[model samples]
Target: MSKYLLNKFLFTVDRDPELVERYRAEPRATVEWWESARANRILGCHADESSTWLCFEDAEREALAAHDYPRLFELGAHPFLTLTLFIAMFERDHPPLGFQTEYARRLAHVRLPYPDIAT
Candidate 1:
């Protein structure tokens, strides 16, 4: 799986407030649209500079589309990026610290030997 691409998606989406809201509200559509329109567009560069080789694997796509952060972690997405973006999307739905606690609880089954995150 392309961990770099996955992290790139998280990092990019997390940085843009509008995209963040879009992703939070319509994850599948956001992921599909991003894969089609933004995946290969080099950040801060002109559209002509876009690359042609970046795409999410099916698992990665589905995980992201489902807002399955735990699946993302298992698929080697960076934890910080995942957590930060997820917090932005979901924290408001809970009481203070409740989302974080839920996040931890959801990941409690993960063992020490986490999946390799290196791209």
Candidate 2:
């Protein structure tokens, strides 16, 4: 599932204003571009030091491209990272707490023994 890479995508995109906008506006394209261009680039390291592996699985890619937060949670993406990035992208469209409420509601079906988040 590459939870680490998924979390990395959330974390990285959340921290950058432009990228956040880009992701919100062009999810599929952004996911594709990120996977192709940045997924293997080690953070805080030279480009040449990039890792050779770190691609999202097909389901993971689809979940991200679709902004399916509930699916992301099922895939073991870190909740905080997902929420933070999601809030940034969607909170503005709702009244205060509305998006959060919706987020929780959408994930209400998740039961105990949550998916393992450890990378």
- TM-scores for all candidates: the values are 0.98, 0.97
Encode model 2's per-residue lDDT on 33-53: one tens digit a residue.
999999999999999999998
Candidate 1 ranges with C-alpha deviation above 4 Å:
none
Task: Quote model 1's TM-score.
Answer: 0.98
**Pairs of residues at least 3 apart in sequence or in different chains that clash in candidate 2:** none
Each prediction's whole-model lDDT (CA): 0.97, 0.95
For candidate 1, the lDDT comes to: 0.97
lDDT of 2 at 102: 96
Model 1: lDDT of residue 21: 100
lDDT of 1 by residue, 1-119 (tens): 79998999999999999999999999999999999999999998999999989999999999999999999999999999999999999999999999999999999999989999988
lDDT of 2 at 70: 97
Q: How many steric clashes between backbone atoms does each model show?
A: 0, 0
